[model samples]
Target: MRAPYASDPATARGRRVPEDESSFRSCFQRDRDRIIHASAFRRLKHKTQVFVEHEGDYYRTRLTHSIEVAQVARTISGALHLNAELTEAVALAHDLGHPPFGHTGEDALEKMMAPYGGFDHNAQAIKIVTSLERHYAGFDGLNLTWETLEGIAKHNGPVTGDLPHALADYNALHDLELDTHASAEAQVAALSDDIAYNNHDLHDGLRAGLFSEDEIAALPMVGPAYAEVDRVHPGLDSYRRRHEALRRVFGVMVSDVIETSRALLDDAGATSVADIRHVGRPVIRFSDPVWAELREIRQFLFTRMYRAPSVMKIRAEVTEVVEELFVLFLGRPDLLPKHWARAVSAAGGDKLLLARMVSDYIAGMTDRFALQEHARLIGDG
Candidate 1:
């Protein structure tokens, strides 16, 4: 049974553009299906997670990371007796706005767009769903339910202060209660993202030779996991040993969130979704001990993996790719695909509008497609 605070599809606030309800699926399920089929979601197959798309077939791309996140979200939501469908929908759609080379691409775009209201992946995600997607016959975008949209926009926490332009524009049309916390399902998705990345980055870092098993084996949560695995399965091969220890580490994080959040929810006395929103703080989170340990793990990864010499070299190269592409597209709007012509014409020589149009085009590109365009347009091949 779902918790009283869980979002109910029957009570969903409905989509911006009303449509007949699905006979077999709940509204949140439909939202999940739509997100899965989106063109933006498909492009994640070639978008970077930690490594560039062509770096190796083994590294996780945005697509795989999203899938893993959804899995973790489902597990946590189910354990918490929350609405798993809504949680899964938010998890699956969370990274839809990430550009070609991951953070490197986003950083370059943010610099280029500083004058044009800045660039935020969270806000861009709202933009992509609300306006950029033009597949449906009746609407410009997927027309997801208000609940799903809220989960997507505020999954991290309440939005206050200066809102991202993309989110602001959409909020004006339909109020998303920007100053309030999102539902517990959304909170579950956010924490699931944390668990998924922390676990997988270790796996990927090991695979990339940025660090070794012994190096990580000395870390807080990681050390105990390795010791436990060795006790249970002595003389295990290196590959199996690494996998066993990491899976235990993953389990520990999941269990910690489930236990911690459950206590917080019970203590908050929240009996409805509204109570969850107005509860003044996030109920889903790792235990304080786990949070501190995770920090140590993150710091280790930040220094040893994310900022290693080889990775820094690649970051610089990809940053150049995103920067040059923005410049090229802004100056030569005519080089944009024919489908973008209408939007370009609509810009009517307004620099901000034209630059935003260019930003959308480049932000949607896959890593391979961005590289291909760079070579074709700038003769950089």
Candidate 2:
């Protein structure tokens, strides 16, 4: 049974291009299926999360990270009596807009496109679903339901101020109520992303030898988790011990969100999805104490893992790849793929339009593909 404030597919704001109802699936379920089958979604396998895609097989790529986020989203949504399908859809589609080399690539692209509209993964995601994907016979994009689009547009919270050009363009056609908070499902998806990354980055960092198990054990939530694991299972194998402790840490974060959000939801007294959106604050979040601890953990990761010397070196290398590629393509639109060439030709010497076309083409390249293209075209293999 769904809560009063949970999104119901039967009452969903319908798709932009209306279609016959599915015989078996709800509107949200259809939305989830479309997202899972999207070409952009499949490309996530070779997109970076933190480490570049070619770094290691075991490290989480964007694909695996999205899957983990979806799992956590479903768990939390179910616990809170929200729509799991919508939450899972939002989670699965959240990072579909990320460029080739994770943040490194995005940073480079944003710098290059500054004179244009600037690049934003979140807004690119909206562009991808609403206009970029061209598989449907009846529509240019997926024609996802309004609720799904709204969730994708503002899942992290309300989007205000100057919107990304992609989002701004779409919102002008169909308003996503960018100034209001998203449904409870989207809020759950956003937090699930937080949970998945916090836990997995530790595992990945340890695996990469950037940090040791003993080092993270000194952190706030992690220390208690390690102590409990040691008390219950002394002399455990190193691998098993690491896994057990991290899982416990994951549990603490998940449980905190659930318990704290429940309290917030009850206090808000939002008996409808509209009320939840207009509640003037996020109803889903960690408690103040837990958030403080998480912040400390994030700071440790920033120093010991994200901005570590080894990682920074790789970031520089990949940032150069993205920058060089952006410059090369911006100068020579004739080199773009045939389909993309047609789009560039349609730009008719408009630099901003040409740059956005280049951005879309380059942004879609996998990390390996970007490297190969750089080697092939730039003679830098």
Candidate 2's displacement at residue 338, Å, is 1.0
Candidate 2 — worst ten consecutive residues by lDDT sum? 336-345
Candidate 1 lDDT (Cα, whole model)? 0.94
Clashing pairs in 1: none
Instruction: Write the residue-wise lDDT of candidate 1 on 1-381 in tens digits.
Output: 999999999999999999999999999999999999999999999998879899999999999999999999999999999999999999998999888899989999999999999889988998998889889999987899999899999999999988878899999999999899999999999999999999999999999999999999999999999999999999999999999999999999999999999999999999999999999999999999999999999999999988999999999998998899899888889899999999999998888999999999999999999989998888664
lDDT for each candidate structure = 0.94, 0.93
> What is the per-residue lDDT of model 2 for residues 1-381, given as tens digits with 9 covering 90 to 100?
999999999899999998999999999999999999999999999997889888899999999999999999999999999999999999999998889989889999999989899899999999999989999899988899999999999999999988889899999999999999999999999999999999999999999999999999999999999999999999999899999999999999999999999999999999999999999999999999999999999999999999999899999999989888888888899998887767887999898999998899888889999999999899664
